[model samples]
Target: MKPIEVKNLKKQFKTTEAVKGINFSINQSETLALLGPNGCGKTTTIGMLLGLITPTSGNIFINEEELNYKDHQFLNIMNFASPYVELPKKLTVLENLKVYGRMYLIKNFKEKIDQLIEDLNLKPFLNKRTGELSSGQKNRVSLAKSLINDPKILLLDEPTASLDPDTGDYVRSYLEKYKKENDISILLASHNMDEVTRLSDYVLMMKEGQIIDHGKAKDLIDKHGRENLEQVFLKLVRQKNEH
Candidate 1:
């Protein structure tokens, strides 16, 4: 079974249709990029998958089992990372990881925490309060927490946003290595064209709450007669708006 499968997924808020019957899946160890401008319902779609918002209609399955939103046990195997979500400011980096580890009921907490710190190069700031760290550091900590459960499916929302090139590249590289070492599925939502091109096996271009185009990054760029994914993205989004 695929790591994730969303069938005819949809969500509506009052009179507004936030998601217009989107359907997709993430295969084992594959990365699928979700690309679109603001208010295109990318966040809403991810929210639905995370069970933060109940869908008006659809099904989400993991490991071929339908997901029940009330079943936290099912969600234990899934995790998410977003730049906008913050951990507790008062807690130290180690403290935060330890806290999440307990929540995930991770056995051998020391070993798991140590492995994450080594893998993420988070040793230096392990003792610092979360609020004292820079954006890059906080991003790393958030990632470590996400991995506490050793999730099989990861949902990333603009993970590398707001970072300098070096830090962003570092995170990207680390994620690449991690994906290789573990057969994990990733669903990424991002505006960073370079990030998508480097990481995505397939790209879904969404507009007006629906996927207007989808293809491998190179194919989409070539088909749109653009030099790169960013140009193709602009072309499609702007063309839709002009209609």
Candidate 2:
């Protein structure tokens, strides 16, 4: 089953068009990477998906049901994680998780929180203020909060951005396991080409607010005569600008 379907998605800000009729679908249990340079509308597209921003024009369906910004029923089934977007600075990690769990009306909230704490190895910092934690610690907490409700669709932005290599790999492995166990779908926006290649089943390459190229990561790499995804991305972006 397709977990997400976006058709002719468009978002505009004054004279600038940030997302220009992009279309994509993510199947259940699939991981998709959205790759683009800064100002390429990746974030804008994500905002529309999360109902944080209204699209200028488009259709978005989640699990075959059309999304209504005001009706949060479907929103409960989705969650997003990003180090760039911080939780309340004053809230302790446990408190923050409690708040998010309450928002989702999760049954047995404490049990769920405990499970996440253990699963994410979040025991030591549970009482620490969100603002007091290091960047890598905060990223882990953010991820824990995102999964507090056991969402079916996960949206992540640079999820492993600041972590050391070991921690980053650990987190990636956890995501792979979580998806397989729960049949979760993920849409990741990241510049970490290595992470993308490791986690994503497919990749969409965007430039100046439109999808310029897309394919399976391995296929794209080979098709473009590149040794890696980073090379393929650079080649495509540079080629787009030259034309």
Candidate 3:
């Protein structure tokens, strides 16, 4: 069974339908990207998968079992990281990691935290208050907390946002190495076309709460007679506006 599967999943807020019967899946060790213009329901879909938002209809399956939003065991194996979600700002970096590690009930928590510190180069500000860290520093800490459980399914929203080129490349390369070394499935929502091209195995292009087009990134580029993913994205979005 796929690590994650969504069948006609949908969410409605008041009279607005934020997600309109979307269907997709992320297989073992594969990365699937949700590409869309702003306000196209990417975050809403992620929220449903994370069980933070109850779905209006349809179902989500994890490891062949229908998701039981109340099951802590299922939640234990899944984790998410987004710059938009903030940890307790008053807490220090180390304190934040400790809190999340405890929340996940990780065994050997000290060792796990230490490893993440080393991996993410977080030692410099480990004792600094999370609210005081630079954006890039906070981003690394967010990533560290997400991996505290060594999750099998990871949801990343703009994982490389607000980083210098060198730091951003490091985070991408680290994700590649980490996924290879561990059993993980990733769902990525990113506006960085180059990042998407380098990282995702498949792409789903969404617009107006619907998937407008999808394929392997290169295939999508070729299908639209474009040179790269950014060009293809522009073509699809612009064409829709012209309609």
Best by TM-score: 1
Candidate 1 residue lDDT tens string, 48-74: 888888999989888889888888677
In candidate 2, what are the lDDT values of residues 116-193, reduced to their tens digit?
999889999999999999887898899998999899999999999989998899899999989988889999999999
lDDT for position 204 in model 2: 98
Clashes of each: 0, 0, 0
- List runs of model 1 lying over 4 Å from the truth: none
Summarize candidate 3's per-residue lDDT along 1-243 as a digit string, tens digits: 699999998899999999999898889999999999999999999988988889999999999899887875788898999989988999999999999999998999999999999999999999999999988898889999999999999999999987889888988999999999996999999999999999999999998888899999999999999999999999998998997
Deviating ranges (above 4 Å) for candidate 2:
none
lDDT at 50 for candidate 1? 86
Q: Please state the error at residue 209 of candidate 1 in Å.
A: 0.9
Residue pairs of candidate 1 with colliding backbone atoms:
none
Full-model lDDT, candidate 2: 0.93
Compute each candidate's TM-score over C-alphas: 0.98, 0.97, 0.97
Q: In candidate 1, what residue range of length 10 has the lowest lDDT sum?
A: 67-76
